[model samples]
Target chain A: MIKTMKALIQREFWEHRGAFIKAPKIIGIVLLVTTLIAYITIRVTSAKVNGEAILQSGILELKDMSLENLILFWDGMFIGTSTLYFMVLFFVMYFFMLGSLYDDRKDGSILFWKSLPVSDAETVISKILTAILFVPIVYSLIYFVVLILLMIFYSIILLFHGLNPIELVWSPAQFIKGTLVMFSGTLIQAMWALPIYGWLMFCSAWFKKRPFIYSVIIPAIIAFSWYWFKVLTSLQFTNISVFKSPAVYLGHAMFPYSNDYMGFSGIQFNDDSEAQLSEILANLFASVQRMEILYGIIFAGILFSVSIWVRRYRNTT
Target chain B: MTQMITANNLSKSYGKFEALKNINLSIGKGKIVGLIGPNGAGKTTLLKAMLGLTKYTGDLEVMGVNPFKDRAKLMEDICFIADVAVLPKWISVDQVLDFVEQTHPKFSREKAEKFLKKTKLGKKQKVKEMSKGMIVQLHLSIVMAIEAKILVLDEPTLGLDIIYRKDFYDNLLNDYFDHERTIVITTHQVEEVEHILTDLLFIKDGEIVLDSDMEELTNQYFEVMVSNDNYDDAISFKPLSTRKIFGKHVMLFKNVNRGELEALGDVQRPGVADLFVALLREEEQS
Candidate 1:
């Protein structure tokens, strides 16, 4: 069973290598090039305009800063770059789940897949697992590698200037902490995004024509109809649960380490920057354990089962 | 004891349009059964139900397994080729092989690879890069490697040219078919498969018009070419269908005495294609 599942998931990776493998590499290259160009532009502008001394004084000032701010400086830069990756990961997974089941049916390959000894449940679960677990892991690992390469680029620039970067750059680096937060944070993101992912997969299997359009339009129509009904009945708009329900899930899913689903608050980062790694990690794991998330998970389970059932019978668009 | 596919009053309908109407079938081991039908004649629908790809009423069993209830378990011993070019265009030759090796316990990687080596297909060739014939060859290679008990093919060579179409069935018969295996094929190119089919099934109007072995068909159906003088006598016996060829009346008769047919004209056994048309026309007249 395990071997079958591994093959099925590997099949998913092979089928969607563009989204899983190439997308991350392209994102990494664009980010690295943009960073390099920006740094070079800043250096040339500063040196040509006689502002090099000001830039020099900035690096010298980092030496005099306290350990706390120095660590914050390193973390702020690391997290800033890593933020784009997690953002792209969400969209990559969204589209991956959307097409995972539908593409095969459109191309008539669903018959080929169903001809095998693997059950529909295993195939659908492999798709879910690919969206939730495998893609996130691949994106996170690439993000980490890009971060390391960016830091190494900085080290080379410092060495070119005949200065030791260890005192300012590597000394207060949050390598382990940043790696832990990004990898663990992406998993939490996927865990919170289950309901939305479930809807995508369900639509992928269920809809005969334009599953993407129907997946979005059907929910939009429901929310619109319910809002207008409430507004017209009471002569004032009061109940927005229909609109807010999916918003809450999407919000928490899009932004990781937010408040509990019940609380409906956004990320807890403050100006003081006193938050510890453990505090944020604990908050993320704790927030998804709430009853609200539990309900969402139950809803997701129902959709996933229906997705498998639909895949069993719906061999074509 | 032969493991046979048995269907009891099997019926399938899409809305008001019945695709298959209470069709009962019993296909036994070592027989190559050709399910010949016209468009929307329920041939594909019946094959789908047999392969567990669709829902139907009544009981259907393949090799003692309820196909719809336990398709994956049944697929362990039964395999199907739904159509030509159904294999994913994005999948590479090597990747699909690796996947089948991992997923199907009965799949033999070495056998598939050996068959592949005999062709010009490189390991890294994707289905998209290969021609229509190559894709069919690759699909056949993987299917042949698995020692399945029952093989179901639904128009397996629909779009292929004459050479590829002939090659497709030739490989299937020579390398795949055996006493331990049962093969059920549905095709419109009846002439190619008529020589190979051991049993013949003719379905039309969502019902099985005729189901009998090839030998039984030879006994039941006789086609004769009668001259203009014998045409009136041939018509008296009520031929199932009459088509004019070479200014002679070529008639298809059902269950007529062979000695009388020989006396009337030059008698010959009818092909499944001719028998099918005669049967379909008979259904229409009734």
Candidate 2:
């Protein structure tokens, strides 16, 4: 099993490393340069403010001597760049994971893979692991390295400005805390997304032409039609007691238009102080509830199982 | 005794058309079988059905495991090289080799590397960059690296040049093949594969019309050539199919001995192509 997983991981990396390195390099450079320019601009302005504190009422706050402010500034950069980068990475990961199999089947490369001493279950599991774990971990490591450099550079700017570097350094504790929350949250969320990947694999096996479009369009159609019917009936039966019930009220009453499914439990956010470890754990658990990981795993299993059957019984000629 | 592969009453239909009709086949261990048919003869469908690549109402087994039910396990001992160049264009030969090494318990990197060297496929070259012949060689290298007991090659030499085609079979026969391994090759190039095959199975319109051992088949049928002067005399032997060439009649006949054939015309061994043509002609008549 360990050997199988290793092989899967190696193959995923072998097939994808070129795209991986290229995707992050451009994005990384843009973020790195923009961050440096922002730092230099803030430092020059803060120096001027220090010379004329009497003229400036606010006295150029984070632009001057605070490391926490600089860290926030960097986190802001991460929030924008990493999210987009990770999303693209995830999309590409899915494409390659599902598309590799699809292309192999379409062109008959899968025959070679299937003939080996690897099981269909191993193949499916490797794909899921790459999507859920490997891709994200690689991207995260890249982002983390860039983030550390920005943090170090921010501290140096403060030291040169006659401020204590220790006070000016970004709080490692806060970064760690935030990373833990996001990592745990994302992993749990990935389980829910398993069905989508499974559906892709299922599509890989069943459809001979335009699998990408069919996989997305067919499932979307099914889900959309179901949702459409519900909306239609819900509108017709406006007075239905079920719609007004507490479960519905908690789910849709407070944010009828918004898709936020968390159903306001009065959680508030301020900073690292507000995001206590205990509360974050509670939220993580709450976020997990909304994910339905087991159901999604089962769905993934069913789709993958069908794919295996299709693969086994598929026409090779 | 365990047979290498078996398909019991395997029947497949595509909506209204039956692609395979009540096919029952059993290939014992250590035999090299040849599957032959013309276009749309269901040769590929039978191979696919055996691999569980298509759905069919039949009981199929490879080494006692139903390919559909025990696919992953069944695959551990079986390898298939499809007709087309199916290796991923995004992968280099090295990457594909590494992947096989990792995924297959029986995959030998040394074997793959040796085969690659022998086949003249550079490890660094991407599949997309390679020519059609090279792609086939790369595929063969990866497949040959695995220690599988049951190997299926579907038109393995299709579209290949003479040298590559010969090399492909040579590698299969010399490096990969053994008495412990059972191979089934489906091809239109019957003459090329005739020397290597132990048994021949001919499919026509989704049914097996002829399945016979090579020696038995050869002994049962004779190729007879008759001059126009004796063509009328040769007609009485129930020739399977006949054609006129150089003012002489060339015919293939079954259940005809050389001693009996000398009374009318020259007797000789029928080529695999001729044998297949005769079998197909008989199928058409029946």
Which candidate leads in TM-score? Answer: 1
lDDT of 1 by residue, B1-286 (tens): 5758999999998999989988988998999999988899998889888888888999998888888888888888888898887899999999999998998889999999988987889999999999988999999999999989889988889889998898888888888888788899998899999998899888887888888998888888899999999988999999999999999999999889999999889888897788887888778888
Clashing pairs in 2: A312-B52, A312-B53, A313-B52, A313-B53, A313-B54, A314-B53, A314-B54, A315-B53
Model 2 has an lDDT value of: 0.70
Runs in model 2 with CA error above 4 Å? A18-26, A37-86, A89-101, A155-165, A171-173, A195-208, A211-286, A289-317, B1-3, B263-265
Candidate 2, residue B157: how far the Cα is off, in Å: 0.7
Off by over 4 Å in 1: A51-68, A229-242, A260-268, A274-279, A313-317, B1-3
lDDT tens per residue, model 2, A176-283: 644553455445445545666787878877888888899768855765566567768776534433322222223322222112344334444445743344354455
Q: Tell me, by lDDT, which candidate is best.
A: 1
Q: Candidate 2's residue-wise lDDT over B163-226, tens digit each?
A: 9999888888999888989999999888899999988898888888888888887788888888
CAPRI-style class, candidate 2:
medium
Model 1, residue B270: distance off in Å is 1.4
Give model 1's docking category. medium
